[model samples]
Target chain A: MNWTVRLTVNGEPHTLALDDPRVTLLDLLRERLHLSGTKKGCDRGQCGACTVLVDGRRINSCLTLALSLDGAAITTIEGLAQGDQLHPVQEAFIAHDALQCGFCTPGQIMSAVGLLNEGQAGDDPERVREGMSGNLCRCSAYVGIVEAVLDAQATLAGEKERAA
Target chain B: MNRFDYVKPATVAEAIAAAGAPGAAYLASGTNLLDLMKGNVVRPERLVDITQIKELTRIETLDNGDVRIGALVRNADLAYDASFARDFPAVAEALLSGASAQLRNAATVGGNLLQRTRCAYFYDTASACNKRAPGSGCDARDGENSQHAVLGWSDACIATNPSDFCVPLAAFDAVVEIEGSSSRREVALEALHLLPGSTPEREGVLNPGELIVAVRLPAAARGFARHARYLKVRERNSYAFAVVSAAAGLVIENGSIKQARLALGGVAAKPWRAHDAEALLAGQSAEPEVFEHAADAALREAKPSGDNAYKIPLARQLIVRALAAAAQGTPSRMPALPASPFSAVPGALHDA
Candidate 1:
């Protein structure tokens, strides 16, 4: 059986013909749309290697079925860059060297960006750690990842201060 | 994951009709169901995706000053809601203490409650599990039973319910609003989860073709606003299953205990409420000795397996510590201080 799912990916509308019920958004993005930036490490919800945004909220794409997200809006790692310019989260990740093998970098950056947009990046490091515990890295590069998130928060705060 | 038929129903009636068919399961968030399907733990022939049902996703206030939480409310949204934190802090804390932010955002309230046990044998198809297969001999009784239940166990199954949010919900006298194919009825949240007396395979009392509409919490402990805390002791500091956890809510009037509700998780087949302990603490003076006595009374009937005997003392200490902390209105104890930069545990850390 095939289901027609209409959803917004990045900033564009997409009407997908999905067949398998168990085929997740991670599979759709990687296999169908050729957006292979979202990696699948564990292929389970335990690892956040396939984190993406649905309706502006971060979720594990590996656990989400593509047919269940009809009329939903999604944002992948490819959507984070504005043509030539990088998103603040991506720039911060690069500046802080938050990636080693870079397999889990995209998911980590996307989760951080979602957290920041959700107003979760605060002064408390414990809260930040609790919020970012979903995404895992094999290289054990948590210090750099946490630093990047904090730095991006500080930069955004500074920009707000200048605007004020 | 294998291919299966999918139906996205917009109404509860349609969902019920679909679920009544052979080998059909209701899907809300798919956080746990999809994971199990991918692992071949559960292979339903048809998935009735009910996430699009708008009526089941709302959070509204009832006429009785109680909050009615729809089944499809995301864990992340419930944890961050001001009303949930103010009224039911234990629920918010438990939800926040469970999975990471990304997973929580994807996990729904109903799915979290209906999630299957984390027993290794249940996941391993080679191992015999009664919950996974009827009349299949139990392998967890003598083999690798560390994470198995200690309080409620039959010769058949020892798998523990994995949801942390359910402990507080059980203790706080919450009610589950369920709509079945025949009629709709409300069951107390404590009664919703069944104990593994003999039939460990039947986890809940929900009948076939039944859909959980919402969870209703009654107004009971309104005065105990600040004197409540949820303590989850897991392997790592975050995103790990509880080794032993306790949720305590105490109300003290004139420096004496007026009321108390305590529940233990990760040590029981269901969210084990300490009704005996609550009876022991009622109308007693608020003191360390009383809390210790209550903890002792709660564990008096606890029968643990070989490797899980440590959970008895660990749960006792957690109960006492949580009660004392709640009485004093102190923040939850941080096992390990957070390091400067945010980092997930380097590898899979075992429970302490």
Candidate 2:
């Protein structure tokens, strides 16, 4: 069943011709849209490797059918940055050395962004660990992942203060 | 995922019509359904995505003080709602305790309640899973029975219900409001999930055309005994499936038991409400001995599988601890050490 889905991706409007009902938003983004930054790990929604923002809320793109999201806005890891500059979360990941194999880095960043946007970034390590538990890093680099999220919170707060 | 026809139904009537059709399934969040389809556990010819129905997305308070949670309410939203936290702390805790932040964000309340078992055999096509293929055989009965059901399990299947939210909801006497092709009716949350008796294939009582519009919790807020807790013991502290879990809600009035509601999970085919234990607590004084007796009553009927015998003791201990903690307004003991090699390190960060 082919359907025409008009939605905004990373602030740009797009009209895609989606033919397969089984093809998910993750597939559309990676295969059709050529946005390969969002990696697919488990594809069963167990792994958070395909996490993305749907209307600014974190969701497993692998679990979301492309036809279901007709007019929904999507933000993938490829859309996280403006021009050459990285998002605060991306910068924090680099600063804290949060990645090893880097396969799950995009998902981690996307989930972190969603968490931070929800104003759930807390100072407690346990709280951060629980908040970021959705995105799995097979490299087992969680200590750095926690540190990166915590660092991102500080950076984002500092930026907010500067703007204020 | 196999190719399938998808229809986005914007109204409850449309959804019900589609669901009534042959080989059609309602798509709430796609957290469980899509996963099963991709794994070849369930191959429906048509998927009716009901998330677009605006009526099923609202969460409101009824005049009777009962909370009405739309089927489309995301687990994350329900977990974080201030009203849900205050009125139904158990529900909030259960939602938070299940899955990871990302999964919760995508998983709807209805989808969580309807999620299939996490048994490896059910997921693997090569293995025999009666739930996936009726009368095929349950490989988990002999293969990896550690996480299989210890209660309400038949010879045909022993896969445990993987939902964390339904346990607390069942304990609180939640009601499921369903809209069917012919009529609409409300089914108690406990009755919403069926036990795996002779017909292990039938998971719920909802008809083929029924669409769960909302989940309504009964207005019995005062009965929350001094101790009410949901204890989830799992392989990992976070992001792992529970090996055995218990939800205890007791009402202690003047140091005497007014009412008690106990439900067990991970060790049962359904969110098992301990009616015998609740009956034992009736008119009894709140004490360690009473809690012990109640736990014993609950475990008396338990028939554990070979590898899942540990769950019997674990469930009993959890019930006692949950009651003790709730009595004192705090959980007394930590979760038991995970038997699996992937045990979560205490106070350490592990990705879900």
Candidate 3:
């Protein structure tokens, strides 16, 4: 039996009419919606390469069924930047060389964004490393990753202060 | 994955009815269920999504101070709840320490307990796993058994329950609240999981369509709220399943150990509670010698596998060390699991 699901993917509304309920959110994103920014490294959820923010919480998209998240507001890697301007986490990643192979960058960036949104992350490097343990960098680019997160936190805090 | 109809129910009763549908399985969070489905280990014809049963997501402390944790409470939410974390640090630490933050954000308290074992043989359909296909003969029984069970393991299966939360729940002496067709009931958290006796396929004690709505943590468990510590000995420092983890809590007054609660995970098919050891610790001085005696008595029933025999001493040291830390209200650390044989001890060897 098929189900119709309404999802707000990357701030865009999508109503998927499908016949297969086994289509995971990852598949629905890449195959149906063509939002291929969310990488699928390990579909079993062991690898966080398929991470995306569902309702502002980072979750392994591969492990989530599409029908289960009807009307959910999903934020993929593609949704992070604003036109020519990159998200602070994204800018900090490049400034810090956070990626070697760039395969895990999207998920890593999304996870970092989700971490900042949760307010659990501090300017502390060790805390950032622990909080971002879900996103693995097989390339061992952790030093850069930690640096980027800290720098981004400073920039984000400044932006908030300016806004206030 | 098999073709399954998806049903999202608005109420617990409706969810139970959906579960009655042919080969129905309740899906919460889907962190565990989706993985099982992808592996073809469990093929439910219909997934009864119970996340919409809004009432089941509540986390409330009763007037009596007993805590009721709703079944759908996300692990991340529970871990970060200031009130809950302060009330049960061991339980909260265990949750945050178990899975990746992304996974914790999606995994639910109910699914954490009901998730199946991570036995390689069980997941490999080509391999013989009695738990997956009963009477198939367990391939992990004699092969790659290092991470297998060291206690309460049968010849049919040598698998360990991998939940970090269960150990602390056992220490808390929590009660599992369930809803059935006619009425509601509660089962002690220690009894919530059954040892893989002769029938390894029969994992939990829940009847068909039975729903775990919430878990009630007794107010008495607050004794450990300040002194409790959960120490997991795993392959890596973080985000790995335990090989042997101990949840220890001690209440001391006037230089005597008044009460002790201890439980071990990743060493058995179920969370092994050290009740006898805890009972013996009452009124005894919290000394290294007395703690060693308690640790030994706790592991007396341990029947180790061929390669996992190292877990016995590892678990013993962990219990003693955890108890000491709990007595002092500090964190305890141990070497990683899968260590070289005779590693928990330095410069000491031979059969005891």
Candidate 4:
């Protein structure tokens, strides 16, 4: 049986007819929608390589069934960068040299954005490290990742203050 | 993952009816269910998606002062709720201590209560697991069983419940509300999970189509808010299951204990409430000696199931440490790392 689901990805709405209910959101994004910014690693929800923002909350997309989500807003790594400009987190990742293999970069960036939005970690480096413990980097780029997240948080905070 | 029939039920009655068929399972966020399906550990012929049921997403305090948490409420939501966290700090700490932030945001409270054991043998489909296959031989009994249960184990199977949230809930005497096809009933959260007897397959007390609608915390549970803590010892600093975890709550007046509640996790098939220990602690002056005796009483019946004799002593020490921390009083805010031993009050390492 086909299940129809409506989702707003990065701001663009798409109504998809899922042929199989077993298709996860990660697969739907990479395969059907052709938006492959989200990577699937250890798809059993252990690894956070498939992290994405669902309705403004970071969640593992691989464990979430596409059919279970209807009228939900999804934000993937591909959605973070504008036409020529990158999101603050993406820019900070490059500035801090947070990527060695660039495999887990998108997921790390998305998770950092979501963490900043949650506003729990603040400027505490230990809290940032604990908050980002879910996403693993096989290349051991954790030091750079932690630096990148903190920098991005400061940038976002400064932007909000100036706007206010 | 298997391609099963997807049925989105709009109401509790409809969800029950859809799940009444054999080989049918209820799907909330599909955090654990989808993982099991992908691993071929569980193969349901149909999945009744209950996420769209708006009623089950609420977290409200009833007029009687009882906090009713909807089954579908996300773990992160409950932990971050200001009032709920203020009332049940230990529970919030325990919730944050479990799985990563991403998983906690997606996983529901009901799903956490029903998650399967993390035994490697149980996850490996090639191995024989009595809990997975009813008549299958138990491979975890003698094969790499360092993480097996230390208490409440029969000859049939040996496994421990892995939920950190259930530890504090068990201590606070949480109640689980169930919705069956024909009627609704309630059961204590402690009794919801069954020990591995001859039938290790029956993990929970729910019938085939019965659904966990909500979890209710009694008003009296709030009394422990001032002096409550959940401490977990894990292999990693974070994002890991507890080797031996404990939740301790105390009510002190005039520098004497008025009431006490204690529960241990990663030690038994269910959240083991230390009733004897609580009884021993009542009316006693808060001291190191008193906490040690309570720990002994709590672990009096604990015995190693396999190669996990180390768990017994570890649990005993954790119980004592948790009680001592509770007596010291809960922190004004949650520790940065939730329940980790590393997250304990700074400069207090001398206590350990």
Please give the range of 10 consecutive residues that has the lowest summed lDDT in model 2 chain B. B332-341
Ten residues in sequence with the least summed lDDT for candidate 1 chain B: B339-348
CAPRI quality of model 3: medium
TM-score of each: 0.95, 0.94, 0.95, 0.98
lDDT of 1 by residue, A32-119 (tens): 8889999999998877899999989999999888888888999999998899999888899999999999999999988998888778
Q: Ten residues in a row with the worst lDDT in model 3 chain B?
A: B333-342
The lDDT, on a scale of 0 to 1, for candidate 4 is 0.91
lDDT of 4 by residue, B138-220 (tens): 99987988888888888888988999999999999999999998999999999999999899889999999899999999999
DockQ of 4: 0.73
The residue-by-residue lDDT of candidate 2 on B308-330, one tens digit each, is 78889988888887676566642
Give the per-residue Cα lDDT of candidate 3 at B288.
91
Number of the top-ranking candidate, with DockQ as the measure: 4
Chain A TM-score, each candidate: 0.95, 0.96, 0.98, 0.98
As a whole number from 0 to 100, the lDDT of residue B64 in candidate 2 is 89
Provide candidate 4's TM-score on chain A. Answer: 0.98
Candidate 1 Cα outliers beyond 4 Å, as residue runs: B330-352
> How high a TM-score does candidate 1 get?
0.95
Cα-based lDDT at residue A109, candidate 4: 89
DockQ of each: 0.64, 0.63, 0.53, 0.73
Off by over 4 Å in 2: A162-164, B222-227, B330-352
**Candidate 3 TM-score, C-alpha based:** 0.95
User: Between candidates 3 and 4, which one is better according to DockQ?
Assistant: 4
